[model samples]
Target: MSNYTVKIKNSAKSDLRKIKHSYLKKSFLEIVETLKNDPYKITQSFEKLEPKYLERYSRRINHQHRVVYTVDDRNKEVLILSAWSHYD
Candidate 1:
């Protein structure tokens, strides 16, 4: 089991900075760590995107917020595209 390197986009970093709640922020970071180990395991709140474009996946940070990312298996990298409230 190889670990993946997680990279956050500039837009995603902007979104993360906008997170006001402490718990949501913590959970989001935790989820990112989990992705480093395994980004393909799908649970209730963690799954691949519907269209499956670019091997993208979504992991919930909380009820409203989620982390959107794409997996690069060959390079073992996870690129975070967004980390913000989905409903917002």
Candidate 2:
């Protein structure tokens, strides 16, 4: 099996394809960098996370920053579905 995997959720992909209004450009970029540096750590840390939204999930990367995603437990892959500001 592959060591890691990264995927974009269908809804997020669809949203991104139509509108790039820049909700969390920098946050999203940071997530990309984090994933590149160490996908396993993020994935490991996120294994216990539960989705806050109706259809998507999210977890914190550094301090209170969030890394929203859905993971494949079988392959231990981390699929970042979205990113949200920790305001509410």
RMSD of each: 2.0, 5.9
lDDT by residue (tens digit), candidate 2, 1-88: 3455667666556534332455555556666566644454545335434444443455454454466665566775667665543463
Per-residue lDDT over 31-86 for candidate 1, one digit per residue giving the tens place of the 0 to 100 score? 87789889987677887777876677898887788889998888989999998876
lDDT of each: 0.82, 0.54
Q: Which numbered prediction scores highest in lDDT against the true structure?
A: 1
Judged by whole-model lDDT over C-alpha atoms, candidate 2 comes out at 0.54
Judging by TM-score against the true structure, name the best candidate: 1
Where model 1 places Cα greater than 4 Å from the true spot, the runs are: none
Q: Tell me the spans in candidate 2 whose CA falls farther than 4 Å from its real position.
A: 1-3, 14-19, 40-47, 51-57, 60-65, 73-76, 84-88
State every prediction's TM-score relative to the real structure.
0.85, 0.45
